[model samples]
Target: MHTLKVDSVQLAFNDRKILQDVYLHCNQGEVIGLLGRNGSGKSSLLKIIFGTLTPSYKYVGIDDEFIHYGYLNNRIAYLSQDSYLPRGIKISDLAAMLIDQLYWDDFANLDIYKNHHHKKPEQLSGGELRQLEMLMILCSKADFILLDEPFTHVTPVETQYFKTIIKSISKTKGIIITDHQYYNVLDISDRVILLTDGCTKHLKNVDDLVTYNYLSGIK
Candidate 1:
């Protein structure tokens, strides 16, 4: 199985520290749920892994090879919190550039794409645009994906469908996801990780979320 590893990550802004002594690993066919309190640097960690943000110290690798920048490798993908599609681009053209050939049929068949293929991104509703951005990343050729707040601003039905897609995609790619909707993250993750005080806490179960003060109680 392919593996994505991030270790020895350290980040700080001026005197304020964000991440230090962090380590995380995900294997193909597994989903890692990342849970943390606000200002815990969850997005920073994902950015570091994606090579968009440079930490003070880090060692990232996929399988046996070390990577200095994630985008350079092309085997990793990231979904950010905000919409990223450019203007003046048709949904169909965007798909042609981003979606993998192997998953083209499945990508083209999604209601979000099928209905809006002829429209530009700006024409769609906010939620609809979010759905399309996510699908493009999820259906890419990358073997490892880092998703930040993926479940935000979507309908309950869309959230559940995204979970299904994530689970199904995990059969072939490793996924690391963080969302304020902790339960949604928990629902799909094969393994859960808590980011606290700039370190990674590998949780044994949902109860650990409460213990770490990420949640008051687990129902």
Candidate 2:
């Protein structure tokens, strides 16, 4: 089983302290949610963990070994809010680049493909683009998947489909996702990380969310 441990990570950008003494732990077969307001270092922490940005003190361990970002693409897949599809690429091409069966007839049955009619990335709407982005990410076979706002701009139906896929992925892989859709994320997350002013705290249950005002009122 895969796992990640972040020990007292700190990062700064040109004198701005983006992340401070943050710690988090996620286990295999678990989906963890990272929540916070805009510019609160949520993405910075993810980047530090994934090795995108150099942390002031990066103490990231996978399973039990310490590693760096140079090898992350082979071990983890990070999906940003933007799709990295080549400017002239088609949906089928994007899937093929990631994995073959992902663009097969089985995946074709998905609403995303059916609605987009296998259109080129540049021609698709934002929601459709993100769906394609998600497909590529899921097909990559990475042990750890970090997704930022996976549901943003997607339709409700598409969001449901994506959530199902994420759950399935978590059955075999570790997932760390951040989104503005806190309630929906809480529904699927095995653990929740709430960030405020550069500090992070783990929320154990839905009750904590309600008690901490992270929710309107738990359902």
Candidate 3:
């Protein structure tokens, strides 16, 4: 099984320390839910793991080898909070670039792709584009995926649908997902981590969220 381990992460912006100490581990077939309040550095942590953002110090690796940049060689795929598709790129071309051969038919045959493959990113509505981007990231061929606020701007039905997709895809890829929609994160995650005060806390159950005050109480 593939393993991704990270620890000893330290990040700060000017005088404020965002993350001081953290440890996270994931292997194939696991989905780890990351929860934090606003400005808690959940997005920064994902960017650090993906190598898009430089942290003061960090240790990210796959197996035992150090991974300086997780995005190199498609070792990991990242879906940031912001839109990633460029207007100059065609939808079909982006698909050819990111989708694995084994899943091409499944991806190409999706109604969303069929409806938008011929149009530019600018042509789709904000919500439509977000849906397309989310689908593409979840379907891309990568050993691991880091998703930041994936459910944002998505409809309730789409949120539920994507939750199923995430769980299904986790059988082959290790995934770390974070979003303000805490309930959705909890619903699909195999295990959960709450980031607070520059620390990582592993929760034993729903009650732990309460302990951290991340949630008022169990739903």
Find the candidate with the highest lDDT and give its number: 3
Ranked by lDDT from best down, the candidates are 3, 1, 2
Report the lDDT tens digits of candidate 1 across residue range 1-219. Answer: 889899999899997899997998999999999989999999999989988899889999998688888877468899999788899989899889888898999998898899999999999998888888898999998899889998787999889999999999889989999999998999999999999999999999899888889888877
- What is the TM-score ranking, best to worst? 3, 1, 2
Model 1: runs farther than 4 Å from truth?
none
CA displacement after TM-score superposition, residue 132 of candidate 1 (Å): 0.7
Model 1 global lDDT (CA atoms, 0 to 1): 0.91
Which is the winner by lDDT between candidate 2 and candidate 3?
A: 3
TM-score per candidate, in order?
0.97, 0.86, 0.98
Query: 1 or 3: which has the higher lDDT?
Result: 3
- Scored against the true structure, residue 40 in model 1 reaches a CA lDDT of 96
TM-score of structure candidate 2: 0.86
Error of 1 at 13 (Å): 0.6
- CA-lDDT, candidates in order: 0.91, 0.77, 0.91
Model 1 is weakest, by summed lDDT over 10 consecutive residues, at 67-76
